[model samples]
Target: MPLMLPFAVEELEVFGKCTSGMWVYARNSTGSRSGDKIVKRDIDLCDEHGRVCVRLKGLSFREAEADRNPNPGATFPETLESFMLEPVWKPQAVHTEGESLGYARHLVILCGMTGFSSRDTAKRPGGMQFVQLELSQPDIAERFHACADQVFEMIRDLLTEKPQERVLLQVVVPSQGDQQLFAGLTGLLQSAELEHARLIGQTIILDTDIKFEELVAILEENKISREKRIRYQKGQRFGLSWNELDAKEGDVPVPWKDEGVYLISGGTGGLGFIFAHDILRQTKRSTLVLVGRSALSPDKRTRIQELSDAGAKVVYKQVDVAMEDATHALIGEILRDYGKLDGILHSAGVIKDNYLVNKTTEEMQEVLAPKVRGLVNLDEATKELPLDFFILFSSLASTAGSAGQADYAMANAFMDAYATYRNSLIKTLYRHGHTLSIHWPYWKEGGMKVDAETEKMTLQKYGITAMQASTGISALYRGLASGKSEVLVMEGELTRIRQHLLSEAMEQVIPPTAVSEIKESSSTLVETELDTGNLTDKVLIALKLEVSKLLKIQSGAIDVDLEFNQYGFDSIT
Candidate 1:
């Protein structure tokens, strides 16, 4: 083994490639055999195992230090309480010296961790090697490597950048087992007469008996005032605790997720556009796929071009989930493009004023196709994508009944039941984070009303349209992207309706006066269906007028009584 050098190496990243599962491909700057400037190399850590693990390549010690202290506005790990922060390695080009030139700093860090792994079995993953530990644990049967003590030695070995600088370890003892082990280790170190090894807070605080005084000395030595370092430490403490904002779960930290994907329906619609835009802005190197029925308009094409320019990798396709073939084709395309799908947001549906009894069978199918059949279609299409989430965009009307919207309400109710069943199935298959069913209250704008007349109805009824002339595909996309099932009810009649729904569901207490008043309400509020085969002006007027009234707006004024449009709407009534 090489002579030990005291170099400060506190900030460490544990990234490895899974040979059998996932591997990172590195581009060589200079190829020895092919004379190629860029050559691909598979960086798998293990071979013949279930998974190959690989570490990050070409990390320089100097660059790692800079990365650890990136800027004045750097974000630190919330779990770290009061520890020295410095990068163990930095990003750089790999030299011809191979492992000898590249992993010098990494090797040092590995040495400290090895020491810890040598003692305990649980802390160590099997098949790892160290300079001192040749003997493996006998009690362990599954590919046993070094114990926890060995891991600690490797970790401590890498913590020093300079002999003069002292390394501070911030150990988060979440469980009693960890706390007990740490205490035992500290006691053993003290008995061994090690010059270092001092207990600080709740855990073993090495290198400092009094952090306040030691921090002052460090600040003064490093040319920083005590007041500044104190403020900085206080700020860090505040931020670390701030992660406990939603402190329902214990203080024990959850491991960070490196990468994820979000699959959204109606991604090309107005709502989806907003969601994609925000995601592109918020996330790093995340791909957003927009699923919709309509082809991109020229204006939307421009937006997509902008997203592409911004390096969003935005993908859009016109596939109506109502069509089984289209849904199957979409699934195939997604699998081919991305190896696995992570999240899904179902936001495709159609809305029209058609009461169940009054609506013609054809008209009923037209509205229900997207909500009922389309939801099932989406479920089938996304079955293959190792789905992290399968969310449905249901409506509050699924809970609370709306007048003259029997078809729409029924469609939404089916959506609720379908979501519940699918969620149950997913839990049985792959139980993960809270699988949820979300219901969004009626939006004033967006696709809430597809046409200008629908817009008029919304304005008249609610006095404001929550929807954008375009739909809010993006908001729904965001809700699903977040891995939560939530009902985003706006702050108006929609909220009221949602509350009413919950109340009715819990108590079944429909007020008698309210029911009688509903019964006595104008019949115009009731939807009148049009007979598709029967040609009459009354049908046209009924369709438009009833729809308009439900929207709380006046019907469109036409000069002629009803003249039929191509889709069988009579203009000359």
Candidate 2:
């Protein structure tokens, strides 16, 4: 007795046989029929050359069972297995390696479901029925040869078994609303870290009652253009001109005095010390309060004593800002001892590097505690104080979304957002207080643990030059004085930074002409050779040209000795 296929074969085309005895064929068929009417239509299978083979008419379990011979029946295979059927035509010559076979041999798996029925049974209504289509790719199938039997069993179960209602409803009615399916899909694609397999999963929401043809059309469109499924966001770049730097120095006053009390979190760290020393230098009588999780070392204590002797009181306190009660108590103690709270600088944060999938909830919270919760605690404790500045130290990762730094990025992004929110409130409640979040690039001396190899790769491949302590401090001061709620400080050639950021879909945020000018300036330093007089003249001419362009005036109207403020330039510009 001959075996019967579950579905009707409509057409078939044989390409040729490979040396390995594997016969490649294309198939076109329809799925199961309901009451003599075809349910699934235009199901196609072809090779890279567009040759069709094994086309089927329709699929029906009832029809297939009826066609089977009852008396000659034998036990069926428990697993879905492949068996060769005699070719409808003579085999053609074997093709050479790398030859086009006329069909898509690749397979993409999209797994997700849409709303079928509400939990409320009264809302149930009749909907369109769908016929299942089974398609396979030889290349993909070969990859799972070791688990062939298991794969076959899974397919058999899918076709013949009924899942629990709860399990079935999960795919149909996911906890995350259907409207957000696209966002979830793009996120999955972006976060995937596939090394060998070119597979990605995405979610699509469809009405349960959608026509079968429409569903097939949607799947086909996505299959043909996978790139469209991934989404990207635009990012921003920040820079300062030589003229702006000079203007910032003259316009925005630090307002630091010998009697003011300034607090620095993470003060025992390298960056904290630098800021502490700079604050001392800026004022003759100000008091510096440095907070860290550990006690100051003997050497650090001696250094603090020196600053104390220099007339600025230096105090070091051991405190973890993440402890809300402890941070609040510490703030109260400072206010009591100093009679005032002049400023607060938050530089406390932690980092745990791992791929998003591998990151644990505890690790994320550990990083977020000091950065996000600490800020909230500090702000609540000092809400009534007339502070000069409230500065939060953030990172460039918040903007660029660096791979393996999701937790760190999320914490910093919170800081960025909170700073903006605080600034909005400050305009009304504490007009004298400024809330600023500074997004900084890599610092050569002070940062989370970074080995030499990683640093070298970051600089060479990513075009990111770690900021020198002196330059970073200068930029920090300028950023604070600029009166902006948020600022990003970056160090690199603009063109190189732009190129590096292209993968993040943020390259276009920076103007091309600005990058060109920066590139040209750096190139000029290497290529130009001139005498002292000629170089001085060239420098003066370039300065005048830049000023003219900035002021929107002719170069002839610029005077080298005139201050920028005289040309209608202010800190806002």
Candidate 3:
């Protein structure tokens, strides 16, 4: 069985005229075939920024599959009056007018009542009781009501149970009732502002004894096409007039196809991959140009191929962005290939963690190599190009100093300062007509995980560790994108470090020891330790006089390598 059919004669003509296949569906929970397999196509006829129309191919009926079709040996006779009272009786009525007029390629007029079986050879009537009617256009509410004035105007057939054989049910005319039921129905429809509705009961009845053909002719005269005019009226047997159908599809505009390119750095890594996935899922498809050093690797190539297979324009190039010449050349090549760059995300980084004492001067230089020098190289190379974003991956240790990580902290500190300086320069250049935006993210996760011992040591000095850094990076990016000058990635650490530096300055203002006490106390302690662990008053006074003479000589000598931890010594001695 087909899912839906073009029942209205006027809509059928439009369906026949359509070179494109159109389909219909019953808007009922029980008859709904949503999520079922259907065919789709690229079309230019649909309204811009709207959902695509679908064409039904087949059916998966619950009733037929469950062996619940009670009418096994029933055959329907083709007549116009047969449809007026019982449309489902003529289940397989193939209307040439419906097909030739372009109502639909194939359709199924869904019914809640049992349908006649055309497969049986005997042509015997099947036993099934039904008082159901699918009203095309009642100009009433969404559903049928029993007490409404419109209810008294419908014609109905009542079925009685008998033990022997089946019989043609007795017809009931609601018009004979004291109050015309159709007037109540018309009132109900008027309140709802509905053009069509449906009604089902124990017997077949006409809520309004209007024929579908007559309604289509009325709709055609009013310039309403057949497809737009046909709607399955709920609970009411009557169909709607042509002027009632809304011909809205033809007046809207069609939208353009999505076409663009997205550029990404570190596109092969975990965070980069996740970002790419989100971009692909949330937005329309676009060409992707990935910049990374590992693009030359076989594993990276394989992964990129997989992404390409999944409908992404995956492209990669091998270049260490830390090198100036290489970065310049690669940027030139990318610009040549892709006419323009949409955006960029820089996630390249390295970590250097060691105690201050253990760090060599050479190691310090090496640690600063990537962020300080590499960033400058990248900035210089891409400055000429019409680039949209320049993101620098930074660290929290830069703002908050770490105890056992002086080198990494100092290096990151340079990055923090450099980013600000570069961004300022870019803005200044923009005032003179160059457009470029710079961003910086500090302490992101996945680059390096700080251990428990390392975190404790770092926190003692910096007051915040790696996790805070990662979160700060994301927030900083968001804030910067929202047009902030420079966002302190971690507000808490920035405040703490500022306070700590200021407190150390206040301690330097006041004196701790007097100049006279330094001269007397130091001489006495030395003399007492040297002179039999005890000193007479005359001996102590003599020691003080000798210390004065030595102090006068102490200012002249420059090279002195005595054990200063033991006691104070004269440079001349």
Instruction: Name the top lDDT candidate.
Output: 2
Task: Give the TM-score of each candidate.
Answer: 0.39, 0.48, 0.35
**Where is the poorest 10-residue window by lDDT in model 1?**
238-247
Which prediction has the highest TM-score against the true structure? Answer: 2
How high a TM-score does candidate 3 get? 0.35
Error of 1 at 36 (Å): 86
- Candidate 3 per-residue lDDT, tens place, 173-221, comes to 2321211212222211121211111111112222234343432232222
Residues 65-153, candidate 1: write the lDDT tens digits: 11233563532222211100111112222121221111111111111122233343332222112232343333211001122234233
lDDT, candidates in the order shown: 0.41, 0.51, 0.37
Q: Whose lDDT is higher: candidate 1's or candidate 2's?
A: 2
- Runs in model 1 lying further than 4 Å from the true structure: 1-259, 355-358, 430-435, 449-488, 492-573
Query: Candidate 3: which stretches are off by over 4 Å?
Result: 1-271, 294-306, 403-407, 430-445, 452-477, 490-573
Q: Candidate 2, 484: how far from true, in Å?
A: 2.1
What's model 3's lDDT at 380? 65
Residue-level lDDT of model 2, residues 41-103, one tens digit each, is 444344455554333333222121222325534322222111111101121212122221112
Better of 2 and 3 by TM-score: 2
Rank the candidate models, highest lDDT first: 2, 1, 3
